[model samples]
Target chain A: MHFMTALRAAWQQRDSLLCVGLDPDPARFPAHLQGRSDAILRFCTQIVDATADLVCCFKPQIAYFAAHRAEDQLEALVEHIHARHPGTPVVLDAKRGDIGSTAEQYAIEAFERFKADAITVNPYMGRDSVDPYLAYPDKGVILLCRTSNPGGSDLQFLEVDTSKGRMKLYEHVARTVAEDWNASGNCALVVGATFPAEIARVRALVGELPLLVPGIGAQGGDIAATLAAGRTENGTGLMINSSRAVLYAGKGEDFAEAARRVAEETRDAINAYR
Target chain B: MHFMTALRAAWQQRDSLLCVGLDPDPARFPAHLQGRSDAILRFCTQIVDATADLVCCFKPQIAYFAAHRAEDQLEALVEHIHARHPGTPVVLDAKRGDIGSTAEQYAIEAFERFKADAITVNPYMGRDSVDPYLAYPDKGVILLCRTSNPGGSDLQFLEVDTSKGRMKLYEHVARTVAEDWNASGNCALVVGATFPAEIARVRALVGELPLLVPGIGAQGGDIAATLAAGRTENGTGLMINSSRAVLYAGKGEDFAEAARRVAEETRDAINAYR
Candidate 1:
């Protein structure tokens, strides 16, 4: 199935807009699993099992796994997610970009090696760097537009002059990717929920393209404002992601139950806004 | 030793500016070494051994090894370079960037795991995304400025309005990184050898900061123009990299010798220009 079709089916089945980010910091794993060799894998599997019915997708940030030399565990986690939760898509948040041949290698890394349903890519190197990812029509390519961090504005908010007119660098990226790219209909934009106005602007530029909205929970973004600015006409094009808030809801052995409760609450909260 | 000090010592000792890129494409590996489990490692070590005396630095593009599930080989290659060619620096061309915590993981991947002396980074995510790499006072953080690819113009050439009036986006990056972000003096800029004018512009913007210049050999960059545009006042601060042209110069049993010959010619060509 195409990435969008699978994503939509999961959204409909779970009635959820929440995407749980599986960023398992080894230092933050539950005490029981802390010393285990498979700690990250075990922690991520529990989180996925707990929240499978409450999420539209799962995003595993590759850096966390890479840091611990657990790439094999990452591969296992994605396969487990596919086997246990068939419809819910897995987006590997790798944000990789490079020249042509190197970009092809990254595509193989994200899609073939890790079996990610979608992957985030950096747009700094422009079209050719991104074309290899977009070539995978069954997979989604999420390009960074405007990020959530405090220093995001350092370069993204610069005013750039284009043939159309003058617009912020992020706006230019949104419009160009929405119009010039996206030929296969598998492209998505990453617009931080903290920047609701920028989210609205990106939504306007790229009509119903999926926006992976981070910063809703731990990054201090308001859900009401995010929904007001990011949702599509039919209210289904946003993936509001919350990592730390849902994963660390409880410190003890009931962590899975706590995660489930938080996931359900976040899903309900997003649904209420929708 | 500091990265720049090591790099300068190597440049002065070798009397060369060429950086040999060890991008071992399995499909392009010589016939005798093709099917071996250690093909990537053997191929790269052979190239490094052959060309170590001719080049100032060895750049192993991580994608080439990562594509083949040979990251262990990459680690071995860096260790080999450091042990065999002591003064020469190894710049891992990773082009990685992310949020703070994730960026720290990437830094560990490049520095601790692979033991690269310098690593390339993408600047689209701004200051905080880059700080983790900069925190390593002895390592080098080479930021992507004007790339050599055809699609680089799609974004890098866009005119952006800064406080000091309008300039290109890449210029702004050079100025900001040189002026604000180089507190540790470990920062460098990647200005493609393919665009000599932009290289000159970037060199002017970031006064004495090192420039990692790719696009020299197989990418069709003019050596004399690159030297004229990128060289510092003392005829240093430029690392002109060539990958395919040097690595795949021959397809037979003498491939390593062929690589050494090409590397020597390229190094001499660059030195004559300087």
Candidate 2:
């Protein structure tokens, strides 16, 4: 299935916009799983088995797994998700960007090796850095615009003089990606939930494209306000991500179930906005 | 040895600030090394062996090795460079940046796993994101400020509204990282060789911190002018990088020797400015 259809299916079945972030830190894994790649795989399997039905999608922070000497484990993690729950889309949060030729390899890694339905990318390298990823018709690319971090304001909010008159740097990014590079309609913008006004402006620029809204949980971005800023005539384009708050709900054996409860709450919270 | 001392040693011996870049593409790996990791390893080993004595440092662009499914090869490539040329420092060209805890893992990976003396980073995540890497007193952290890409101006040149007045965003990043985060003197900035005035301006702010100036050969950045703008007191803190111009100088069996010749020429080009 195409990424858009997969997203629509997720929104309809789970009745939630919640994307459970699986950034499994080795230290945070269950005691039995510490420092062992097998154990890490097992923990992810259990989390997927338990909460697979509760989330619209699963977002795995690649750095956590890549940091371990077992960078190869990322393949197992993504494959496990696809094998058991074929309907659930996976977004690999790699935030990768490089030169033209190099970016193509990352596309193959994300779309071919891991088979991620979507991948987050850094736009620092410019449009050519991202063109290779956009070539994949079935996959989605989430471009980082205004990040959830406080220091993001240091750069993302800067105003510049373009041929189109004075414009915020991110607004230029949104307009270019939406109008120029996104021929396949697989482009998405990562607008932090903390800044609702900017989110609204970016949403207007990137018309029907998807918006991957992070920072709802530990980042303390207001969900009601975020939803109000991002939702359009069709409200399924936004994928709200909550990582630590849901995944590390309880440190004990019932952690999976605890995760389920928080996932449900987060789901209800977004649904209430609808 | 301290990173600055190592840089100075390479400079005094070679009388050049050029660091030859090794970004070998798998498809372009000389015909003899096709389809085999060991062959690629051998080729890189020879490249280091040939060019080590002529240049101050070797920068292995991680993206090339990472493009292959065999991520294991990237580790071997790093090991080969260090094993063959123990005196020459290896700069792992990975522009990595994450939160404090995650940044620590990257630091360990770049410094310990790969044994890189320095690595490139993005400061968009703020001081906390970069502080973990600076904890290692021996290694240097080269933060991206004004990049060489065409779209770099989109955000790097943004005019910020501040207490003092409006200032370019890259200027703000330079001031903040230098004043607040440069406590260890291991912190540096990547001022693209393409932007000479920005290079001069940022140099004034940071004061003698190492600058990794990329975009010399294929990217149309002028070597003579860049050296003039980015030169330090002793011509010791500048590590100007030239990748394709040196490494891919010849596609034939004599590629390594061709690489060494070009590297010598590049070293001469920089020294001529002094």
Judging by TM-score against the true structure, name the best candidate: 1
Error of 2 at B7 (Å): 2.3
lDDT of 1 by residue, A166-264 (tens): 999999999988898898899999999899999999999899999999998888998988999999988899999999999998878789899999999
User: Model 2, B90-131: lDDT tens per residue?
Assistant: 888778765565678778778887778888888766677788
Model 2: residue A225 alpha-carbon error in angstroms: 2.8
**Taking the tens digit of each residue's C-alpha lDDT, what string does model 1 give over B32-65?**
9989999999999999999998887889998787
For candidate 2 chain A, which ten residues in a row score worst on lDDT? A154-163
- CA deviation > 4 Å runs, candidate 2: A159-168, B162-164
A189: Cα error in model 2, Å: 1.5
Best by lDDT: 1
lDDT tens digits, residues A1-274, model 2?
7777888898888777888888777678767566564766777777878888888889987767666655567788888888989889999887776667667877877888778999888776677778888888888888888777776675566675566677777787788789877888888888889888888998888887888888888888999998888887766668899988887887888888888898888988988886
Q: Report each candidate's C-alpha RMSD, comma-separated, in the order given.
A: 1.0, 2.5
Categorize the docking of model 1.
Answer: high
